[model samples]
Target chain A: MSVPNAQRQIDMLTKMLRIREFEERVKRTFTDHPGVIRGHTHLADGAEASIVGSLSHFKKGDAALATYRCHGYPIALGTDTKAMMAEILGRVDGLCKGLGGSMHLTDVKKGFLGTSGIVGAGIPHAAGAAWAAQIRKKREVVFCFFGDGASKQGAFAETLNIASLWKLPVIFVMENNGYNVVTTSAQEDANAAAGQPLSIKAKSFAMPGVTVDGTDPLAVAAAVGKAVRRARRGDGPTLVESKVYRLSAHGNIIAPPGVPLHYPEHEAITVFGKREEYEAALRGDPVPRFRGILVQNGTLTAAAADAITQKVVAEMEAAVKFAVASPYPKLESALDHVYA
Target chain B: MAQLPYIAAIDAGIHQEMRRDPSVLYFGQNLATTENHEFVAAYGHDRVRVTPISETAEIGMAIGAAMAGFRPVVELYMAEFMLVAMDQVLNEAPKFRYMSGGQVKVPLVLKAGFGFACGWAGQHTGSLTALFMGVPGLKVVVPSTAADAKGLMATSIRDDNPVVFMHHYLLTLEHGEVPDGEHLVPFGQAAIRRTGGDVTLVATGWMVNRALAAAEALAKEGIQAEVIDPRTVAPLDLDTILKSVAKTGRLVVVDQAPRHATVGGIIAADVVEHGFESLRAPIIQVNARDTTVPYSEPLEAYVIPDEARICAAVRKVCKTAR
Candidate 1:
């Protein structure tokens, strides 16, 4: 439960940089290689520190499930970015054989079980996996990720109650990005409107609730690491409200086939006209903020950070090339996998 | 073989799988509340425990457990309870294997009872077989006998897909000879309850008994009817119905659900499209009246398909000529 050492800190920063770079490529795909990616694509540029830190404690036997803002978890879990990109581009070599697009990226082999496009639906699914882990008696845990909006869903309440009652080994990580699509948390969430942290809702279920600065990887790691240990010890589930800001709009503008799709400006500026708030979030963007902290603390040198950045940029660049060059799946293969 | 009630046969099927596969889990609302409960006694609490009245979590947990390499049978008790968690039942459980491109198999069973028309009233007495039968990735099983109940439940557990095993509430205590052990009835096969030449009677679940009684009445009237019970509706045995139609040259479909929601309508459409030449008469469908089943006994009886309705439909089909 102690702070991650220098090596682990550098590793966490590397992962955050990879996620930021991968999300940038996905955003650029709208213009750089128009029409290559289809459907709604959510970006995880701002939540990288929280994602990487929580998953840093992941082990071989553990499992993780997340919302559609899913690209970051797999990257931290060591999934092949090439296959992930191919999946987003609907290619034969895709992670899910092109059947599941960006929203449903899954790598069971890597213990990244799957993602649910619907808000709050995947929460109970994580508890279900935790039940399996409990039955296995291996002290393994499950990490369940969703947004602050998902906390309003009935699945969240039902699952939290049952998870605590059964003492299921799962962590409910709510990334409070301040918005559920275009609606702000204060508009939709009772706790937020009352000026209470969303984590306070967990008290009703009789489990520990903690709020952390999601923009800091070390903070998230420390908080989530304690919960992981408690879960491993069969204590019960915990609810961690990791507060972060989404760097992009909820997703690319949804449109018909004839009209082109693209990512719009963040709702802070576009919908709420709060340019100053958006500017503040941009200045505190976790990816660069973590890098600056590492340099100031002497855990990482400028040259080392730059080298890591160059490698991740080249890695993602190759992923885009490979994905664009990959061929579409066979038309008839659509009929496959309808039944197992 | 041994004589067992429909409910016990279903339990036998579950016990059959749970005994062999330690990974098979049976849990639901209010079933295993005590340690001495039958399932918890046999399999222990790790594999059997009582869940809260959270349908969404119950089915969703089953899907997650299934993905993690365990076969879970969620004891839903009533099919209408599934409506409370349609997203998990319709979207999540069935879509995982397909959306994951076969990378994960959701091998689980949703055991729910349907068609309890004995004064249970509208909300509790619906025959919702057709609602689940048409979902692409779901397998819907409607067993009409104790033997088929044990066998189909076994097969549903073994099948590597999401299965909705809809057992009729009226048949909970109906006794029949079930196989002693390892009884597994394959899906997508029809059971010919009776064979005749004048008309073919196609039905499922409780309607099969009504169709059989109607066939007997039709036999006495010199209009022989062949009764066909399609055990599993999703992987429907259309070929058997077509072949039966070819021999009888007349078709009569009886369903306990409303007219539009009847699986018979789907089967009738398939027959008309695929076996039009085999029919000497227009297919007659005898479905329940399109209304909520009333609480009154007579009104409920009038709303549901009965032996008289099936016999009337069969006789009507037999009267038509090529």
Candidate 2:
């Protein structure tokens, strides 16, 4: 690749790598602290590039709505990593004030409407946001991200139809990660989950639908950029299916599942291997690669890269410490928050 | 002032509010310009939006607008339709303020009609005030008189939280004097429409009228029942209820919803919890029987709370106290 192109790839990868490393750390931090979060924690450790690429193009005021496993999107949207980590720890300073914990992270000020714990529930919310923006004559668009599992939900199709009908500026980004928790999308019982490609489903809405290589951060970024531009021009909603893999067990197993489990280790490893190879073939990391290219192109320098990373790390660390030092919420506070 | 039904008072309030604030908007099925109702003509198309058949999406749109700082009033047309938009009402709107760390305010008013009148059948006449009251963040209002209807509707529209304003289909034609001026009926305060000393008759929506009628009948029998109109179910006027229960030492709750999850149950539970020591008798609840509201007028009348049931419950509570 040319110096500029290689640099771009590197910058993207670094962000991806940061997400991957962050999730790994979260799992490790919580291993001994089993009481940190009750219920399930779906990590996005391996599916970093897809989120990094997709979020790269989101403007400051643009909205993002994602499914329950939504750590990566907020991280990409400039939320502090420590706060997210502390949220997993169920500390008061967490994004949702330790109330939502792992599966639901919401920061309205950051333009993240909050992640829905319900499958495909966020789809309608994103469409609603897009509709509001359109009615208010605001230029902002909303990006709704969900897994292939969510694509089969009734709300998903309903929202897609409405967005297209209203010509709302919304982008539906389906991350086809093959598995939804334990059951693979192919084995899901729903008729909609039956043999049709997702992009083809989007086409049924009479809207533009395309599939992209999710592992290729640049490809994902390019797809998002175009869709965003089309939406801003009032071309209506688009469904972009990013083909990716769940490199880890749906959550926290680290290795692939045992044979008795529906999602066998062989299939898991094979899918995981594809992501690993792509990640390895690229050199120096996406961030460094992009920074180096930027220096060569006279846009940024190696010193600036160090400065940006340092500032971001410090900011993230401060959020973590703040959450850790913050007092636990009062027991009575639960009553006040739920109803008001 | 002429007597107007509860539904007419609500319509009047909505029309008045829209005329007062251009930012205030209303949306629902058949509530727009196409209907050619005087309300739609006065509000105009810009403020009066006609929505498609997607109830969930419509409610979601209202919540989104409220989040974006637009004061939106959404009419569900029927309480049954609220099921489709339960996620938006219970999950999103209520959680917005706390979930966003008190950063966002959802100034959305969701209005619905409930209760059996004509043969609207099972789906059309469910009084969901009790179900909605169970939700922590929402304010549930059920008005009886036209004055309370207009005053409470104005208060709900101005309140920051998501308020569910339920009007009985029966009350649409029923009339009562409504003050033709600005008035705010604060929630959590009960109206002692008819005061007495023998027993406390707690009621909501149309049941308030039934309770009063029952009280009048009981008055002839020297029962002297006190009729309390809650008006708001969520910020329930528990203080007034407990005070009345303390004085009368007897309680009877009349609700239009089913027996299982009735507003009657909540009031009874509250009385038992707080007013148990002061009680001179076991609490009684007059609610819709444990069956769906039937389409046949006879079956419907037998199932829902009526003046007969209210009178019987008042007599029962009075007997228990004696």
Candidate 3:
């Protein structure tokens, strides 16, 4: 096991905690206010490490596109969380001036080209951005973050073909969260065992492919680091498959604790392993796991981790307050942006 | 004044725009095989990119490129292919500016060859101006003549919005005098093709040419039809059409699209609603038969609105059937 340095682990832990707390806070806000965050949200509860890990390798010129579960990405990309929270709340002071809502948080200056609600749509956007990078000689690389459901979209295949053909600097980060909405991959495909791993599908396009345990932030960062290096060196694109689980409903709209198994036991077991393993992966979430390792390695103590949590909590509290206080857009200004 | 074929004028116009601005580039399939070779020779391969035949991805790619500060003119080969990229067209590109709250401007022009008279059967023949008109942020332009084609090509490229530029297949074969250089036609302005007072003939795309011919035919019969060509739709020159309608007190709309929810239908509705007080007779709209265009030349001609159909609409609106 190649463990990253103590500092890297601490940083990942902090990011993971921020993501978890943000989603948790968003979930709580939505529950309490009901209509506070107007649009639907795809919370990033279990898939924190996959985004933060890969983005850790992202630089100033690098651009990233993610699916609708975008709150985590912009937050990790260093966007103004207050504005993002305001945007989700549909306040005029939001990042997108309250137009984007939860599904479309974007800050071009922050190198988050944006997020799309379309399942596999962001794939081509990344490929084109990478092409732009090459055309401008920007030496910029693009990272596309999508989910298991997106793999089924034709856009995923089309973008892969184009990216490899042009040798564009792009990384296809498949956050395999076990299920495509309610149907797990095993349920959707009768022979999940026989099928090649998702990353191996990159072989047809002659691009490098690798899989990592998404629960381990170190593993994701390492795999993505190599891909980013290869891309920066002009070695074309790579398909990096990070195995994770949603750990929540597709949108978490109506899901509650102790919800009945929507699918079969064999399906759930096949995806995350035995019940104990599946439960442990959720309970020993990467955020706490990394903190534990940091303590064991004498990097930091539990009190310090709690302190970090307190800081993040206070920050999110301020963001929500700012969003709640922000004004709604004027009704007459609705027709303003229809053109240029 | 330099006379050139409609295709050459548009090609030269694009080349001129590309030279004027380094940001303007082309993305389509087989630029080396088609009319885009001149583009490659002039601008090199980096700017004139011959993309693989993936309409959906290419549209998204073009939208992305536009979002990333490049003015890309993406060709859909035939307007029929716009169906494949409907998501990118109606949903993605059109909604980008509005949904982004004007933070992002999509200075992208999607060019496609549109018609039913080309003898290219059902799947290839499509007049989709109406389809685009339904979307709020999409601008649809169909320039009928070589001069207008060149001028409008430059204007659409320069515009900071998503404009659908359709080159009529038959119009491309027509020769006309094009302004030598830097000819620009602003959108939302209608060109008065012929002046008369008896009836107003409103047309678009190649139908403009047909309407002009119909107006000439009516002139010989003493009908005195005024012909107005709306160079662009969506910002449809409502003032020009309504002014002509008010002057003539009778309106006949000519369009190549089918009758159902087509551009002709929309124009007719607008005339009936806003130009109601200026009507001498019930407004007449001459559109193609609502059926899949057949491959045979005669059937193709039958499917598309032509001079005879336009003249007939004019006569009916004038109540002077002869």
True contacts kept of each: 0.67, 0.30, 0.51
Candidate No. with top lDDT: 1
Candidate 1 C-alpha lDDT tens digits along A1-340: 5788899899999999999999899999999999899899999989999999999999999999998899999999999999999999999999999999999999999998889988899999999999999999999999999999999988999999999999999999999999999999999988999999999999999999999999999899999998999999999999999999999999999999967788999999999999999999999999999999999989989999999999999999999999999999999989999998
Local error of candidate 3 at B295, Å? 2.3
Interface RMSD of each: 0.7, 2.4, 1.2
Off by over 4 Å in 1: none
* Per-residue alpha-carbon lDDT of candidate 2 for residues A1-340, written as tens digits (9 for 90 to 100): 1122555555665576557656655555544333444456676754576788888778877888888888888887867777777777677666776777777787777888867777777787787678667766667888889998888776777778778877888999998876777566768834335766667777778898888877767778888778888898888999998877655556543433331212223234455455444345334233444456556866656677667666555664565456556777777666555544
Q: Tell me which residue pairs clash in candidate 3.
A: none
Give the alpha carbon lDDT tens digit for every residue of B84-193 in model 3.
Answer: 77878887888767766677788888999887477678887777788888789899898988998999999999999989998888787799999987899889999998
DockQ score, prediction 1: 0.82
Model 1 chain A lowest lDDT segment of ten:
A1-10
For each candidate, what TM-score against the reference? 0.99, 0.87, 0.94
Query: Poorest 10 consecutive residues of model 2 chain A by lDDT?
Result: A257-266
Candidate 1 is scored at a TM of 0.99
Instruction: Evaluate candidate 1 and give its CAPRI docking class based on DockQ.
Output: high
Better of 1 and 2 by lDDT: 1
